[model samples]
Target: MRVYTLFTPSHKGLYEDYFLKTLPDEFELHATELFEQECPTGSFYHEGWDKICYRKVELFVAACEESMGEHFFYCDVDVQFFGNVVDLLVREIGDFDIACQDDVTAYCSGVFVCKASHTTLAMFKAMKRNYNREDQTTLNEHLHMCQHKKLSPAFFTYGRVAARPWSGERFRVPENVLLHHANFVIGVENKKQIMDYTREKNFS
Candidate 1:
């Protein structure tokens, strides 16, 4: 399996460094840097959340087309992997066209496993055409219309789980979790501090 991720200017001093350092060597990793010049024409290139989502779809579809692997996994740069995620995903994907963690309203697009097929390509195209609220929302809509596997939160923990202490919520990080995503819960500096702590605690 091949893993693909995107990085924009705002992520430069934040996620980019940690992600590049921590990404395992076992899988083929494709990291796309989204510069203003690279943004596709006819698309809003404003420096905002929507622009980031648009670039993610563009980069993801490009990676899917360029990869030779039968299966492709897309992960946000804010995610950290502790195990052989590709192996785990390949085993868990089964016969589904796509697999991801369900985030109540929709499956989180931060981490997902997709089979490289015409159907997958078409779904991505449809997602690009229907740029609504965000990439995850659009992806969820398409996923609802296709064959997909909804992974348990244990496999791909998000910010709510990672930052439970801040919200006065208690949760456990499952022993089998392969990936942890630090979503829009905290600022970049705080994220860096947490990443430093995580690296020393687990990855060292």
Candidate 2:
């Protein structure tokens, strides 16, 4: 298996200094930096998020094909890996075209595993139909049409502070999650602070 991620030029330092340090050495890791480009009207979400998201998907698919990897995992830069995620995926994601954490309303796209196949390619094509929608939403729509798996909540958790459905209290990061998604709810500086704290306390 292979792992992939995309980062912008502004966050290159974060990827090199922090995110790269958290990755296990068992699998090949690929990180690509985004380049500036003039996007066509209606081709992206606010501030080029959609374009980057689309590019990530395209690049992931190409990488899988080039490497002939059976499966590949893609994650946002804000995610920190705590364990050998590829091993966990091998044990858990059996025969699924894609696997992601369910965020109740939709599967969180921040971290996901995809199997290389015609079906996976078709799903990416379908997602391109709605470049204006959030990537998570587009992914959910296509996932529902294909064979996909949902990772257990214990394996993945969101770091964003929000109202919890179970207790109606603010959400908190659970202990020992394989992947922690520091979504855009908090600012980048605070996200880095949280990651630094977690690394020192739990990951160290």
Candidates' lDDT values, in order?
0.67, 0.65
- Model 1 lDDT on a 0 to 1 scale: 0.67
TM-score of 2: 0.80
Q: State how far residue 142 of model 2 sits from its true place (Å).
A: 1.1
Model 2 over residues 1-204: C-alpha lDDT tens digits?
Answer: 678888776556667767787788876888787756424221225466666677766775575575454878877777677777777786667877778876655677777877877777767766776543466777877776678877876554442334232222234456677666655434455556666655554544
TM-scores, one per candidate: 0.80, 0.80
lDDT of 1 by residue, 1-204 (tens): 678887766665555577766678887877777665343321223436676787788776786677534888888776776766666777778888888865545577878888877777878888898887678878877875558986666454435454342232334444555566655344555556565554444543
